[model samples]
Target chain A: AQTVTQSQPEMSVQEAETVTLSCTYDTSESDYYLFWYKQPPSRQMILVIRQEAYKQQNATENRFSVNFQKAAKSFSLKISDSQLGDAAMYFCAYQKGATSGTYKYIFGTGTRLKVLA
Target chain B: GAGVSQSPRYKVAKRGQDVALRCDPISGHVSLFWYQQALGQGPEFLTYFQNEAQLDKSGLPSDRFFAERPEGSVSTLKIQRTQQEDSAVYLCASSRRVDQPQHFGDGTRLSIL
Candidate 1:
């Protein structure tokens, strides 16, 4: 069984500042994928960033980036230049590799981000 | 629609009543998924479908819950004799392929009174 853990239940960041949301997972499979998703009040989940377990280089999407440590099983999202719009619920997810024959996502409890102006 | 679309943004059903939620995936998406999210909790996988074939339904809570995607593009999740415990937001997602990133819909909030 794969389980994702988001340690921070809530976080606050001043506008234009940077913030990091921590995430860790436990999975026996060596090949897998990690993801960070944001859900605003509208209730639609938007993909923020993604990282492949085999890729040593972290994944970065514009202002968002991830610190993916395969050995420690830690994948954290760092939001640079945080704005008010960045306030939302962030969730970390895990998925098995393509050859694993399954496409289910295991999600963490989520961390509520509050961007202060 | 350009993205996955779920119908009846909100639903209120009395206990013991039956309810159905609809999900329309992307035009050419080959894989669809259904998830249940309780208040203040992360979404949990409920079922998965490849084309019109339901490949995995292990996450469904009970026999009262049923889903079908006969035509492959449109899917529906039906709950019979709804209970208070079943109240939650039902989300739908789709991807170009099983290995692709999933695009999620706004979700349908179901409430059982």
Candidate 2:
């Protein structure tokens, strides 16, 4: 079975500071994708960033970046210059590619981030 | 017309009541997915559909939980004789193609009483 783990149950960050949330997964598949998703109080799940396993380079989007270690099966999310608006439950997910290159994802437990003023 | 959309944003049902949750995938999307998220946990994959065919249903907790997409567009997740453990946020998502990014709907919050 494929499983993703986010060890941090809760994280606190002062506004403007940076934070890193760690994630590790157990999978035998070599070709896959990684993603970070944010769910705020509004109850909507939004994609934050994504990275393909074949690519060694990490994935980043403005304030969000990922440290994806394929060998270790680790994918950590970095939130830079965090703001109050960034407070939310952050999930790290893994997707194994299919025969046609499409894939289904498995998500980590999640890390609740609280951006304190 | 835009992002994925789910109906009955909130639902409350008794233990034996039957409930149906609807999902409208993005237009032209070829892959649709359903996930069950318990309180304070990441969403767990429940099923996957490519067009009208149900490709994967391994994530469904039990036989009581069922899902279908007859036309490969709109999908419905039905739960029979709901249990207290079934209470959770059911999420629906879709992608234009298998490798494309998935767009998600806000989801339906189902609370079992």
What TM-score would every model get versus the actual structure? 0.99, 0.96
| Model 1 chain A lowest lDDT segment of ten | A97-106
lDDT of 1 by residue, B1-113 (tens): 78899999999999999999999999999899999999999999999999999999999999999999999999999999999999999999999998889999999999999
Alpha-carbon DockQ of candidate 2? 0.71
Residue B3 displacement (Å), model 2: 1.3
Best by DockQ: 1
Model 2 segments more than 4 A misplaced: A100-102
Candidate 2 at residue B45, lDDT?
89
lDDT of 1 at B28: 96
Candidate 1: list runs displaced more than 4 Å: none
Model 2 C-alpha lDDT per residue in residues A1-117, reported as the tens digit of each score: 788999999999999999999999998888788889999977788999999989999998998999988888899999999999999998888888755343667888899999999
Q: Candidate 2's interface RMSD, please?
A: 1.6
Q: lDDT score, residue B102, model 1?
A: 92
